[model samples]
Target: MVAKRRQFITDSILLASSAVAFPHVAGAAQSKRIKIGQIGTAHAHASGKMSAIRSLPEIFEVVGIVEPDKERRKKAESAAAYQGLTFLEQDQLLNTPGLAAVAVETEIEQLTPTAIQCLKAGMHVHVDKPAGTTMTECHALHDEATRQGKTVQMGYMLRYNPAFELLFQVIRDGWLGNLTELSGTMGKYANDATRKQLAAFPGGGMFELACHLIDAMVTVLGKPDQVTPYAFRSHPEKDTFADNQLATFHYPNLVATIRCNHIDPFGGPRRAFEVAGEAGLFQIQPLEPGKVRLGLTQPHGPFKKGFQNVPVRKTTGRYDDEFRDLAKIARGEKELAWDSKHDLAVHEAVLLASGMPIN
Candidate 1:
């Protein structure tokens, strides 16, 4: 049975890679400039995403920003990225004439609520990672967006990453035969201030960082039968945050583990994901400027059996493709790549993995 499965996967890899290699390109003529707004700047990636949206003048026009926290607004105003951006109250941004979409970039606690408000206001939203702390609120927002036929694009950046896109294609093509084990590690050195910021969440580093890998794992493996989380505060610092954590996801056919830490000496180059299967293995390190290494049982297509470095298209930047996709969905040029069902499942898995209460 295993041999047959391996053969099947090897055969399918070619077909899968072909389909993913040539995705439907969004056309310039069909592109419409989407009038967008941003809500909150407390999330770490909020300013970066806003700046990215502002750069894409042809596809998006960021009309205004809604930041409720005076302190947070003041901090953001000092950043060059947020400079010159209109600051409006939440209601004003939501009620702006011809508003087409909103980017929900609030602190983790406020993500779902703000997204729900945007959906209620008849605007599509790009809610950031983990989809907030609660499953109920995330579901409520997703359901409302579904009922209104609006898009809720989760800010899981890797979904738009070219390297991950190639990895997904390889898996779908059966090039990796019967995925047995998948592992990912994401970590960084957190300073006193960053550690304090992360200490606010129970899951700490895992909640803030590993959620990215969890999103990718769930995308490839779907919902797991069980998620076992091991959270720890390995640092000597006097903080209650769980600075080191690992979550093992058990599925019928696959067992995956994700490890995250806030104090890795070599975290930058060590950030990586690996997939091991009956027929092959694939690894990507330094997930940002993604570099992939592929291994097969035998030579298949352009890849050799032992190992080979796979090259992918250069990433324009983190948020460029994501905002472009959002604009396309807002303009009715294409349906959302991820639907409410997928987002809901991903959020559920993330909460479970992060050791957060789902109810």
Candidate 2:
């Protein structure tokens, strides 16, 4: 149990390494740019996802967009990312000729159902996170995608970050021998409106934000043998809002901790993940477009002993690499890096950690 828990690279080492070696060119066949569309501009990341797709013009062509809600559509229409792009009704966009894939960026609850619709319409999908607040929709969506022979890429962007890419290799190679403890913090100050929005979900802070780190945790540690959750409130006068949350994941010889809060003014810069092994310590704070710190007992590869900095290449934006890879998978040039089974494992862990009902 202990050995399996720390085996971060259970998926093919090539699957793990391809992230570091991103922009991996497929066999001699040259594939054309995939024609893609966006659905539902209400999600926080909807515009950003659209922008990322447009940025990779070499990999994808923006066919059109779908935003069902009139108010949300009106707001998104004027956003810089959506300007000049045609906005069509849901059916029109899904039925567009040559529509190879869709970015399902609906409001949190609609994410899975929207993606499932695209899959049924013969489009691959990039659905955003938490897979919704429960397991039922997530299961149905994955089942439909599998039945349709289409890819459903969850919107967890950290998997492609260069720092995480290298860290996976370090731990997998036994550079961090015998992982003993791991902890991560994800938090941001949220006002009344935000808290009320996130509170609708069972885990509130942890479900809304910490799920990102939870995805990272399960990626490195696998699902915890058991997870003990602590949910409490820091909201001034609200009782239902779990504004502060923590989960302790139990393993045979390892312990992992995930903490999230809606009350950190410095939370943006404080977001961090740290791993402690007998041989070394690896930490990344403010974890996106990641900056890393490494402490080693002895030199490993080109990295020196003691605390040394690992150079992370400049990231144009977090979504660029994922969308580029999405294009390849949509074009049949490559297989999905992390498959449906892995995605379900991550969501199961997320629900467990968030104190949400699994069903």
Per TM-score, the best of the predicted structures is 2
- Tens digits of per-residue lDDT for model 1, 95-173: 9999999999998888988899899999999998878778888879888998888998889898777778778778867
Q: lDDT of each model, Cα atoms only? A: 0.81, 0.82
Lowest summed-lDDT stretch of 10 residues in model 1? 10-19
Off by over 4 Å in 1: 1-25
Per-residue lDDT of 285 in model 1: 94
Q: After superposition, how far is residue 53 of candidate 2 from its true place, in Å?
A: 0.7
* lDDT string, candidate 2, 94-195, tens digits: 888999999988889889888888999999999988798778888998999989999998888877777777777788788878788999998989887887
